[model samples]
Target: MTLIPRGFTLIEMVIVLVIIGVLAVFAMPDLSVAAIRGQIKESGPLLDVAKQGVVQGYGALGKFPANNIEAGIPEPTKMVGKYVTRVDVKDGAVNITWGNSVNGSIKDKVLTLRPAYVDGQPAVPITWVCAAAPVPKGMVLTGVDATDMLAKYVPLECQARAATAP
Candidate 1:
């Protein structure tokens, strides 16, 4: 009886492995972008929660929070495993900077939240800025305008704050 080859040859196996490696290299960039997008989406909601806390604290004390410590929310907390290094309220806005160690470098992102009135209604706009390395060249960080971005996401109570503000 004649013996027949039952599996791929050594060369065929090497070629298959090489193809997989090439495909992985091409796919890695897409995966990274997807991850960043997810992070960006998550950031908006967290800022909303924190902003609500700020408004609540302000309503109770008759002033905006002096700092994240006084904002009535946990500080230095992790959002999706990334450390939120700082949050500050300034000029009727909240600024949040967060970072995480990735591949030996600290990747950081900044978000700015502002209270504004839209369509005769109050709203909060949150802008995201990424300062991490390996970012695309000439990638502008200017966030969307406060009025445009926050019109849909702002909470009802936060919207009232703008109306009540002198």
Candidate 2:
């Protein structure tokens, strides 16, 4: 009687690799999306920094910082951690610009934080309304605004502000 070979054949190995390759192809997009979500979550603290800068500036200078420079927020050309790009303060609103590191759809969009200072007095509990910057170029969007597109990602307080837009 002849001894039977038990090792997997080269053909079987190749087939298994191909299956794995196909599975990876299907899984890649989901992984990318999860990564983007993580990145978004990480941005919360960065945004808080911007908010703190504005609030402190208002408290000390008796008004909002004229621009990002006055607010002490550096304008970044590239992504840093969850903050994709620069943090701008203008007109009592702090705008955080997203860079290429963000997901394709939401990339380059701006998240604006408007601190409620009625009559130049800081509101108790420091109320802030989140807003969206104007849409950027190359996005073939119509009828809907940036706030609408980014609604899912925006914080709850900002969602109400976006919805009330005239």
Candidate 3:
């Protein structure tokens, strides 16, 4: 057999190490961010429940619900989920507070679900919007937006600007 080595060169080994380091650096933030987003998504079902309560109240009263009680939802402190500590319905908006086994970066952060509908048209179906998302043209948004979390930790659809069917 020939005396030539079959192993990688020193320079090639160094290059591979550098590439791995670079990839790890880039992947760290995304991994952490994805973990945070997953924790936040655990509250989605609770938010939907609150939204339903709000819509029921609106349909029955011809106006938005004033609070959890008016919306027929459980008390804010009583509506708890795996990663959410409370779900509050105020002025027909569902505000979710993340906590209770959530990541430190997102604990206590709030996300709001606001209701939107065509102005003066009760027949039109109600639509939901993320915190601070612009209401569609000719739509009215009811309730106060209480989203207090950073955009990076939210789902892609819930980032700074959320889109709704117009």
Among the numbered candidates, top lDDT falls to: 3
Q: Which ranges of candidate 2 are over 4 A from the true structure? A: 1-38, 76-79, 120-125, 132-149, 160-166
Taking the candidates one at a time, how many backbone clashes does each contain?
Answer: 0, 0, 0
Order candidates by TM-score, high to low: 3, 2, 1
TM-score (C-alpha, index-matched) for candidate 3: 0.88
Off by over 4 Å in 3: 1-3, 160-166
Q: What is the model-wide C-alpha lDDT for candidate 1?
A: 0.47
What is the per-residue lDDT of model 1 for residues 62-89, given as tens digits with 9 covering 90 to 100?
5556655666766634323343455555
lDDT of 2: 0.59
lDDT of predicted model 3? 0.83
Q: Which stretches of candidate 1 lie over 4 Å from their true place?
A: 1-5, 37-46, 54-82, 100-106, 119-166
Instruction: List pairs with backbone clashes in candidate 3.
Output: none
Poorest lDDT segment (10 consecutive residues) of candidate 3 = 157-166
**Reference-based TM-score, model 1:** 0.48
